[model samples]
Target: MSGDRKEVVKLLAEFSTIGMSVAFSIFIGVGIGYFLDHKVFAGRTSPWLTLIFLGFGVAAAFKNLYLMSRRKDL
Candidate 1:
C-alpha cells in the first residue's frame, strides 16, 4: 500500500508539472523571439521570427509532453 501510494504521488507530481513546464517553455521561447524581433532585429523582420519561434515552442512542448507520457515508471 505504501509503495502504491508513492507511485500515485509521483504520478500526481508529474502530471501537475506537465502544464507548467510546457507553458514555461512556450513563454521562454516567445520571450526570446520577441527580443530578437523587436530589439535585436530592430523590428525589420517583424512577426516572422516571433511566429517561427512560437511554432518551435509549441513543437517542443508537445515533444516534452510525449516524452513525459512515455515514461515507464510514471
Candidate 2:
C-alpha cells in the first residue's frame, strides 16, 4: 500500500509539471526569437521572427503533450 501510494504521488508530481514545462518552452522560444530579432537584427526583422518562433514554441508544446500522452505509465 505504501509503495502504491508513493508511486501515485510521484506520478502526480510528474503530471503537474506539464503545464509549467509547456509554458516555459513557449516563453523560452519567444524570448530567443525576440532577442534575435531585436538585439541581433536591430528591429530590421521586427515581428516576423517573433511570430516564427511563436509557432515553433507552440509546436514544441504540442509535441510535449503528445509524448506525455504516450507515456506507458499513464
Candidate 3:
C-alpha cells in the first residue's frame, strides 16, 4: 500500500540520518584529536597515529552503512 511505502521511506530516512550523524561525529572527533596531538605533542610521542586509525574506522563505518543502504532488503 501507499501508506506502507511511505512508512518505509520515513524509516529509511531516519535510519540514514542516524548513520550519517554517527559517521560525522567519528570523523570530527578523530580530526580534532589529530590536530591537537600533532600541535601539542609534536616533540613527544604522537597520538596522531591513533587518530589516523580512528579516522579509517569511521570511514569504514560510513562505507558499510552506504552498502547496507543500497541493499534492497534494507
Candidate 4:
C-alpha cells in the first residue's frame, strides 16, 4: 500500500509540472526568436522572426502534450 501511494504521488507531481514545462518551452522559444530579431537583426526581421518562433513554440507545446499523453505509466 505504501509503494502504491508513493507511485500515485509521484505521478501527481509529474502531471502537475506539465503546464509549467509547456509554458516555459514556449517562452524560451519566443525569447530566442525575439533576441535574434531585435538584437541580431536589428529590427530588420521585425515581426517575421517573432511569428516564426511563436509557431515553433506552439508546436513544441503540442509535442509535449502528445508525449505526455502517450506515456505508458499514465
Candidate 5:
C-alpha cells in the first residue's frame, strides 16, 4: 500500500509538470525566435521566425511527452 501511494504521488507530480514543461519550452522558443527576428533578422521578416520556432517548440514538447510515457523507469 505504501508503494502504491508513492506511485500515485509520483504520477501526480509527473502529470502536473507536463503542462509546465510544454509551456516553458514554447515560451523559450518564442523568445529566441523573437530575438532572432528583431535583433538578428531586423525587418527582413517579421512573425515568420516566431511562428516557425513556436511550431518547433510544440513538436519538441510532444516529443518529450512521448519519450516520457515510453520510459519504463518513469
Candidate 6:
C-alpha cells in the first residue's frame, strides 16, 4: 500500500479508538449519575444532576468533533 494510504488508515484507527473511549466514558458517567440521582435524590430537585450529565455529554461530543476536525487531511 502507498505511504499516504497507510497513514490515513493509521489515523482513522487512532481517531476511532479515541472517539470510542470518550463515548464509553460518557456512557459510564451518565449511568452512574442516573443511579445516584435515583438513589440519593429520592424527593429533592434533580435539575443539577441533569445539568451535570448534559454538560458532560455536550463536552464529550464537542471533544469528539474537535478530534475529528483535526484530521481533515486524512
Top-scoring candidate (lDDT):
2
Can you write out model 6's per-residue Cα lDDT over 1-74, one digit (the tens) per residue? Answer: 99989988888787777767777767866765676577788626465675687568668767777877786575
Q: Any idea what lDDT model 3 has?
A: 0.70
TM-scores for the candidates: 0.84, 0.90, 0.41, 0.90, 0.75, 0.54
Ranking by lDDT: 2, 4, 1, 5, 6, 3
lDDT by residue (1-74, candidate 4, tens digit) is 69989999989998898899899989988998999999999999998998899889989998989999999876
**Model 2, span 1-74: residue lDDT tens:** 69999999998998899999899989988998999899999999999998899889988998999999999876
Residue pairs in clash, model 5: none
For model 6, the run of ten residues with the poorest summed lDDT:
42-51
Candidates 1 and 3 compared: the better one by TM-score is 1
**Candidate 5 segments exceeding 4 Å error:** none
Off by over 4 Å in 4: none
Against the true structure, candidate 2 has what lDDT? 0.92
Against the reference, the lDDT scores of all candidates come to 0.88, 0.92, 0.70, 0.91, 0.88, 0.72
Candidate 5's displacement at residue 37, Å, is 0.3
Reference-based TM-score, model 2: 0.90
Model 1 agreement with the true structure over 1-74: per-residue lDDT tens digits? 69889889878987998889899889978888999999999999879999888888888899999998788864
Clash numbers, per candidate: 0, 0, 0, 0, 0, 0
Clashing pairs in 1: none
Winner on lDDT between 1 and 4 is: 4
